[model samples]
Target: MLLGVIGDDFTGSSDIANNLKKAGMSVGMYSGVPDNKIKLNKYNAVVIALKTRTIPIKKAISESIKALEWLKSKKCKKIIFKYCSTFDSTKKGNIGPVIDAIMKNLNVDFTIACPSFPDAGRILYQGHMFVNGVPLNESGMENHPLTPMTDHNLVRWLNYQTKGKVDLINSLTIKEGAKSIKKRITELKKSNVKYAITDTLDNQDFDLICSGTDNLKFLTGGSGIALGLPKVFKKKGMLKKSNSKLPNVKGNTIILSGSCSLTTNEQVELYKKSNPSLFISPEELIKNKNYHNEIIEWILRNSKKRPLIYSTTLPKKVSLYQKKFGSNISSKIENLFQKIIKNIYKYNFNKIVCAGGETSGAIVKALMIKELQIGEEISAGVPVMWEPEKNIKITLKSGNFGQKDFFSRALKKL
Candidate 1:
């Protein structure tokens, strides 16, 4: 593989994979770490999708190291560690340890700390990340249930979380062009700076970043950076026109959501107006043993027009669940969604829409979907995936992406 990516979540995995596919490199997106059964020869790039974005630090580090090892075994020359555009993480981070572990294993001296996705309304300036034109702290991400991003300054946030000194590559320095940026990076490395928080406001800034970090063994950022790497690789004759193919899929459709992001909540509300919506509360998932069978029956009863099974709600309810069921309530909900997905496969639902990174990861794992053929996009940062062997099509959407009517639109296209 020319480039291997390790995404912190399934939706983020698809985000980077989408950009790589758009840039003309055939890509394979797998849920969690791939085992010996997976084949790596068909694609130039493979993204290992892991649901470790908000997990415990030790677990995250272990899983990330395993993923890095798999990518190395595939003979990948360069690797990218993909995270959310919002830079979602607590002070005790899974992000920090995961990045630290990856860099240590690769013996990488330094890597970029960029979480900017311009098209997704996420930008970084002066080493501080902004979301939808607001400082990330003012953005809805600050209210995230698991990893509330209360800090907007990427340098400070990463400095506290990472293992080494973190420095900033401000936007002004980036605008000076690739040569200047490369010189700055070299200087930082000499100063023993282990992590450099790069500032990016637009595509031009990202272009300079990709150029400056051309020789680095690792790059860390949001999915938007994937857009810049294809040009770099194409010049090296390491990429080709992506002829992604998939078999036609026609069967019942289902929408499953486990995100509590503001956007996803809005999307669930809008989709509920036209379709049968089943809400699985954390209490019902963890406390009620019969909830699974009940929800499954509900899904079967309303198989037409595609039913939606969601654990999505407002941030307040999420906090309540966390208080009542503990902080790992999200994990319980993910496990619940996986059980629902695994059981519903027998119902012949071929086209599935999974919203939220954790939910997408769970669905893919529960389905044992080893590989996917990249297909047409359902929306920005979201694409329709086709599993050839199972003849099933799935669309994975990050919590903060897509329009309010995304569910209806995706179903219409499918």
Candidate 2:
């Protein structure tokens, strides 16, 4: 593979894979670290999606390194450590620790840390992350059930988890273009900075960041960092125009959402107005071992209407449930969705739309889907993925991605 990417979660994996595909690179997305026997030579890039975003630090580091080693073995020219544009993580993170581990494994001291995706309303300025013109801490991300982003300053947030020094490369220098950014990187390295959080304001800034880091062995950021990478390879005569088509997938569709993000909550409400929707309560999920069966029956009865089975409640209810059942309530809900997907797929439901990172990760792993062909995008940072052998097409949407009509819009695209 020409490029290899390690994503911290399934939704973000599909997000980056979608960007690469749109940029004219054939991309394959995997649910987890693939077996060594699987062939990967046909694609320009391969994304190994791991459910490590909210995981314990040690396990996240271990899994990320294993994925890194596998990619290195494939002779990948460059590696990207992809994370969410929201800079989603706790004070003790899988992001910083995983980056530290990968940097050590690669024996590289300096890399960039940018989580700016302008199209998705995520931008960075002065080393602090913003969502929709609001600081990250003030954004709805601060109430994220799992990895609440209470800090907006990337330098301070990442520094808490990494042993190495973390610094910033502000937008003022970036506006001077790639050469200026490169010069700043050299200065930071001389000062022994291990990671530099680059500030980005718009889509054009992505080009500058990619050009400046073009020669680095590894790059770390959100999907936006990938916007300029395929062109870099093409300039070196390493790219080809590969097919980015999808099989016309027609079948019974289902919407499964487990996100409590503000956007997803709005999407769920908008979708519920016209579709057959069933809300999965966390209390019932923990109390009823056979809860999935009821959900399956409802889906079957409402199959023609494209049923939506969601655990997407308001933040207060989510907090109440978490307080009553502990933090694992989200995990329990995700497992419930997994059971629903596994059961419903047997009934000829081939087109699946999943919302939320953890929910998408659980369902894909349960299905044992090893590889996916990247297809047409449904929205910015969201695309329809095809598992041709299984005759299934899926679109994994990040909780914070897409507009109020996203759920309905995604089904039509599928």
Candidate 3:
């Protein structure tokens, strides 16, 4: 494979895979670290999606290292450690620790940490992250149940979890183009800076960042960093342009939402107004053993309306649940969704549209989906993925992605 990507979550994996495929490179997005026997020679890039975003630090590091070694075994020319554009992680991070482990494994001294996806309204400026013109701390992310981003400054946030020194690459030098950005990187290295949080204001900045860091062995960023990479490989004769077609999937559609992000809440509210919607609560999931069965029956009964089974709620409710039941409340919901998905598939409700990274990860794992063919984009960072072996198509969407009418729009696309 020309490039091997390690995504921190399922939706983010599909996000970057979508970008690479749109750039005309054949991409394979695996649910997790694939077995040794799966052949990957036909694709230019492979993305290993992991559920390490909210896991324990030590386990996350170990899993990330294992993925890196597997990619190396496949003889990948380069590696991209992809995460959310919002830079989702705690002060004791899976992001910083995982990056450290990968760097140690590769023996690479310098890499860029640029999680800027302007199309999604996420940008890094002066080393601070902003979402939709609002500071990250002020964004709904501050209320995130698992990894609440209370700090807008990424350098400080990352430094809390990594051992290396972190620095910034401001927009002024980036505006001077690739040559200037390269010089700045060289200077930063000399000063013993390990990670540079790059400034990106728009999509054009992605080209300069990709060109400037062309020589590096490792890169850490959101899917947007991949926007210019296929062209770089093409210029070097490492890639050929081709069109990607979606598979013709025939089945009833169902939307499962577990994200409580502000955007997701809006989407759920808007979608439920016209669709057959069922709200699954943490209380019911925890207290009732037969809750998943009820959810499955509801979806099968309302199959023609493109039913939505959601656990999405307001931030206050999420905080209350976390406080009352501890952090495992999220896991309970995920487990419930896993059961529902496994049961629903037997009935031909195959077009699964998932919101929330954790929920999507659970569905992929429950279905034992090892590999996915990246298909056409449904939104900026989300795409329709096909599992040809099972004749199933799914759209894994990050909680904060898609428009308010995303559920309805995504169902139409599927």
For each candidate, the alpha-carbon lDDT, in order, equals 0.87, 0.90, 0.90
**Model 1 C-alpha lDDT per residue in residues 241-265, reported as the tens digit of each score:** 7775666787889999988899999
Pick by lDDT: 1 or 2, better one: 2
Q: Over the full model, what C-alpha lDDT does candidate 1 score relative to the true structure? A: 0.87
Candidates 1 and 3, the one with greater TM-score: 3
Across 311-404, the per-residue lDDT of candidate 2 in tens digits comes to 8887888889888999788887877888888998998899999999989999898888888988888889999999977889999999999988
TM-score to true structure, per model? 0.96, 0.98, 0.98
- Model 2 residue 262 lDDT? 91
Worst 10 residues of 3 by lDDT: 238-247
State the lDDT of candidate 3 residue by residue for 310-391, as single tens digits.
9999999988888988878888888888889889889898899999999999999999898899887889999998998788
- Better model by TM-score: candidate 1 vs candidate 2: 2
As for lDDT, the candidate ahead, 1 or 3, is: 3
